[model samples]
Target: MRKILATHPLHPRATAMLAGAGRLAVASALDPKTLTTEARDADIVIVRAPLPPELFQGAANLRAAIRHGAGLDMIPVEAATAAGVLVANVPAVNARSVAEHVMFAALALLRRFRVMDRDLRAKGWLAGREHANSTSELAGKTIGIVGLGAVGQAVGHIAAHGFDLNVVATTRSLRPAPERVGFLSIDALVEQSDVIVLCCPLTAETRGLISRERIARMKPGALLINVSRGPVVDDEALIEALREGRIGGAALDVFSVQPLPPNHPYFGFDNVIVTPHMAGITEESMMRMGVGAAGEALLVLAGKLPVNLRNPEVIEHYRRRFPAGD
Candidate 1:
């Protein structure tokens, strides 16, 4: 019987799927050393954290590592391949969930939802003038997206059709964008946009890509949204901009530090909205991710290419190690 170990927390359905296939080892979380040991006895390992090559070195039977979501930054793909483990990630499965979260954040910030929630609880009246003075209509605003990938494209669709907002993007490559969407230089996008949304991946080239000067160039009163990795935006520089009112507001779903410190200044800022990294979580997203991971695991075990293999080259090395004839 093939053994499968699930280290990260996933939907109950994922556990059921694995159980239906073979022996399933489930854990809410796994220590790095314990996980390494477990992999040796397992045919597949699924997780959401970094899987160093050393962890798989002893896993003679390990065929695949399934990711619960996109963003392979946490895992070492090249290392996994050398160890003959196929690595796969589920992309676009959670795109709609994250895009909706962005819309909620944008609308919440523009309408001052946080402040109103606090005030109403304390005093109990919607002081008309104060609210009206702070709120802004989103219809005519220009929104610049830093990445034109799945989530970015989804956001563009909503903004153009639902809100009639002008959309622009600055992608790694200059590809033809949809109608009413234009490509701009990163600096130009920052300076011209009324709202700046980050949806890119975190790579060496993109680390601190949104530098202090880029933040400084943004249109005054512009709103900033980052659903992407936190380090992409210089956290310290962003704080400074917020302190000086150089930018209007920020809606952050991810932070450089997870579970932001209790005394973090971001919590005290009236113009900033913060949420735990939950932009990609939803009931529907959970189901898709669960099914996707299960399907990939089964494919890898059968010596077939997983549908979403991030490193296709790994197949050559994998076949050499586990010749489970296709």
Candidate 2:
């Protein structure tokens, strides 16, 4: 039986499906060294965590690296292609889940949910009631979305249709703007928005896209919501802004460091809402991602390319490595 390695546990349904197709092994630990050792003999790898490029060096039997979700950042595509490995991913499977999370974070920050809940438990009902004075509603607010990808589009839909808010966006795509959504330059979007949402992918152009200078451009008391990769925003710049109360508040799901260091400065700010990179995780989305990843694995095992193949240029090398009719 061919060996399959999963960086983390999949939904039970996906687990059973892969088990029937190959010898499935879930990683015990996520460190680079541990994953490298565990994946050396794997024919297929379902990636959830970052896969070091060096893992491809000695993985002779590896034919594919399948991402459990949309982001390709976790898998080094260049390294995989160089090693004759196919890279595939389940894209947009969790767009709704992440969009919902963005709304949740926005509501939590605008309503002062965390502080109110804390004070209610520690002090009394009246203390919690006092927080209502500072709360704001979503109606009639102008929301600016960075990147009009699946997640961004979903967020715009909810903001415009569900909350009766105005939606504007910036995107690298050449496509026409969606109805009720106006396209704007990044600078304009940042300046005019009441709520700025970052849904762009992490790339050379986007690294530090929301810099200290841009933070200065934001309207005073404007809210920031980042569901994108961590490094897109300057952590120190944001903290400085929050300290001076330059902006209203922020909701951050991804961070520059995983498990954000204990006693991190962000935790000290009541206006900042921090989450453990779980914006795309929901029971429904998990199953969809898992099943999608597993289906790709099974296709590769059957000597076929995945439907969502991310690296088509690697096909010649892959075919040579695993010749057909063998």
Question: Which candidate leads in lDDT?
Answer: 2
Instruction: Name the TM-score of candidate 1.
Output: 0.94
Once fitted onto the true fold, the runs of candidate 2 whose alpha carbons sit more than 4 angstroms away are none
Tell me the whole-model lDDT of each prediction, alpha carbons only.
0.85, 0.94
Q: Spell out the clash pairs found in candidate 1.
A: none
Candidate 2 overall lDDT versus native = 0.94
Model 2: per-residue lDDT, tens digit, 87-141?
9999999999999999999899999999999999999999999999999998899
Give the Cα error of residue 86 in candidate 2, in Å: 0.5
Candidate 2, which ten residues in sequence have the lowest lDDT sum?
A: 317-326
lDDT by residue for model 1 over 230-307, one digit each (tens)? 999998899999999999899999888877898998888988999888999899998888888988887777668889
Per-model TM-score versus the true fold: 0.94, 0.99
RMSD of 1: 1.8
